[model samples]
Target chain A: MSDIFERIREKFPEYFRSSHSNFGDDTILIKPEGLLPVMGYLKDEEGFNVLMDLTCVDYYGEEERFEVVYHLYDLTEKKRLRVKVRLREEEPVVESLSHMWKNANWYEREVWDMFGVKFLNHPNLKRILMYEEFEGHPLRKDYPLRKRQPRVGPLN
Target chain B: MGVKRVVTGVFGEEGFITTKLDSMVGWARKYSLFVYPFVTACCGMEYMSVSCAHYDLDRFGAALPRFSPRQADLLMVVGTISHKIAPVLLRVYEQMTEPKWVIAFGTCTCTGGFYDNYATVQGIDTILPVDVYIPGCPPRPETVLDGIMKLQEKIQNSKQEY
Candidate 1:
């Protein structure tokens, strides 16, 4: 009932580009430019509906800053798929999936807030956790980990 | 009126004290407790263990939790409070009436643990007035019980009585 990607590979092999480098059976690392089209097909053609979680992993010393992880789930087949999109430290741009899922609104915002990954078409993309006044992205390894307290009151 | 007064005199002050001293009659010790379950993420599940059948909080006479802010006496913040949720949390704490106590449960709530990230609020105490801080990264069931016991001790030892 569930192996939809296998069917895609057999029938429309050109549509599903082979990413042999650092890729798993259910996971694919795609170029930033190819992200939008691939995601659209995955959502519309394949039955992966739920956008479960969107997070990023920082490989600090590397030339590329982060490895963004997008976890998608299919309610019909009860199958899960994870996709990775690698971005350089400077000028990280990926096509936003806000158009596809409502849950992506907060997920993308969090990723932007934490990893500083720029999503081109994301609307109202802001920090979900930190205050507007906060300066640096705390999730970034380069950012210093320091506690900030409100000036109005003594520490509880 | 005179007959009633004579009957009351017969009952006497000694009887009044004795009746109030009885265990079931809680008139003299009416300020029992109304704990606000400030559950955040995971530790809340363990707190359920204490409040539910296994621990039996009613036996101590402090199990009942009042949902409305005005009625509750304690704010048991049981989980992590992110910086984004901090203001709302503070508002909730403010809504609670005077003589309220705050218990910062879990290491994340108390110290923020290994989460040196952007979104996580380092310590809940920085925003709200925390009275008792419980240490544990989502503390174990036994530790939660210990925190409750510690709160009980604090209640007994409190000078400004309710």
Candidate 2:
């Protein structure tokens, strides 16, 4: 597994920003532009075929304010890998992985809804949990806790 | 005075019981309340237990969980209601006919439980008027029955709005 990490770093030294393994669990942090290629490599070569989960984290007061985490699973090898990408605070945009993994569509939508991260070329990039009229991304650190956006309606 | 006394004696029958029309209507309404279960979270499991055979809600006259809001007189909101779902809940409440009642059936529905954040609505009453609130993370069946009983008492005395 460490050999795979070393090979990936050797192959794409520019994209492979850093990597750390704790308790035999590997986490690779890569550039935003390199997200698709790294993920493709992990799926096709490293056998991390299943996109288990995709979620985001908010780090307040940071230059790159959001971190999108992708958990990949290999059914045959029974191994797991974590891939992360950092995005800017102003306008976070990343390449959509929906083409490679079908379930990336909704996972990306949820991340976009919660973190306000835009996914380029996403087929349907809309709010999954929150409604469309929802004002701000609730998961963002700067978003006010008590702030509420109520939509008036005829109520059927 | 002699004529009034003779009329009263003839009209007032010994076998019949007399009561106000409103009280009769209230009694009928209390015993025949059709409930709509708007279950959305973990509390739904407990609600199922409340409805099922062991703790059957039928004994209290609220047996059927009507899917259509139009058919139901009682709305049992059985779980957490997020801001996103609040509008939907309101829509369902509005669709219910006059003389309707709402029961906030869990701690999440009563006070948003631990989710004091932006996503979850703190309480459902901000959007819809509630008649009864059963406050538990997921109240036991006994507690749910007690809430039903309380609602029944309220219904028994309430004016027939419809």
Candidate 3:
């Protein structure tokens, strides 16, 4: 248990779920509602200034189907923290970190494109990797690997 | 030179030769090919090696890469064609002038390689008529040269459009 994790847990006990340290990598599972407050605290107070990555994972059959993961880094303290928010299958929406980090806009767009995870309050939420006409999220577990959509050009 | 020698052998003097306009056009087209390299993925590295001085694509008259499709006579698709890029590839192919040829420069372009997924376009042949297919993940320079030679042979044999 790192000092930062202990402090974060103490600060937001109501929002905190289960947290684990796997091979020195600290990851905290928090409720979707607590995302903004917790991330803001980490960025402003705890010095997790860098949002290294923002991605989503689809657990196809699980109760909480999708997990939006955020990797944060503290440049001054030389530490990394992983924050995850699990969402239900029906409506997987999480608070956008784009306001805090400029790069999160594109990352959120990519996550939306790949996993169909909606980032609420994101300025420009659109497909970043796949084309505009591409249907269905390709990175989801249920997405058929070989299922190709209608092609764009002539079939000659 | 082959046509000249044949004419000289028949007439016993090296003066003039008679040949079909199609063969003459084909011979000229095969010797001066302007390549448009539509490189996207790892195959571009192999393309670079083939076009560079060591491998020398200049031998086949395809050393210069015309960035614009309208200026090129040959379209060399050198890497994976994702579904998103397929439309653009088709547009580029359509932009090229008449008497143009297409070369699928890698296995990805030829047969989609191993990327059998929703994103990747299975093969480029679905959209454009391919003249030559250079099969390799990222084909060696030697294989590319051989493919070019094969294209030259095809050009020399096929009837010219104009």
Q: Which candidate ranks first by TM-score, i.e. highest? A: 3
For each candidate, what is the lDDT?
A: 0.72, 0.88, 0.89
Q: What TM-score does chain A of each model score against the native chain A?
A: 0.81, 0.94, 0.94
The fraction of correct interface contacts reproduced by each prediction comes to 0.29, 0.42, 0.65
Ranking by lDDT: 3, 2, 1
Error of 3 at A107 (Å): 0.7
Q: Where is model 3 chain B poorest over a 10-residue stretch in terms of lDDT?
A: B1-10
Candidates 1 and 3, the one with greater TM-score: 3
| Clashing pairs for predicted structure model 1, backbone only | B107-B136
Candidate 1 chain B worst ten-residue window by lDDT = B19-28
Q: Name the better of 2 and 3 by TM-score.
A: 3
List, residue by residue over A19-95, the lDDT tens digit for candidate 1: 43234447655666667777777788787899899888888889877888888899998877877878888776777
Off by over 4 Å in 1: A1-18, A21-30, A41-54, A59-86, A101-103, A147-156, B1-31, B113-123, B136-153
Better candidate by lDDT, 1 or 3: 3
Candidate 3 ranges with C-alpha deviation above 4 Å: A153-156, B6-14
Write candidate 1's Cα lDDT for B25-60 as tens digits.
Answer: 232122376888878788888788778888877666
DockQ of every candidate:
0.29, 0.34, 0.56
Among the numbered candidates, top lDDT falls to 3
Top-DockQ candidate index: 3
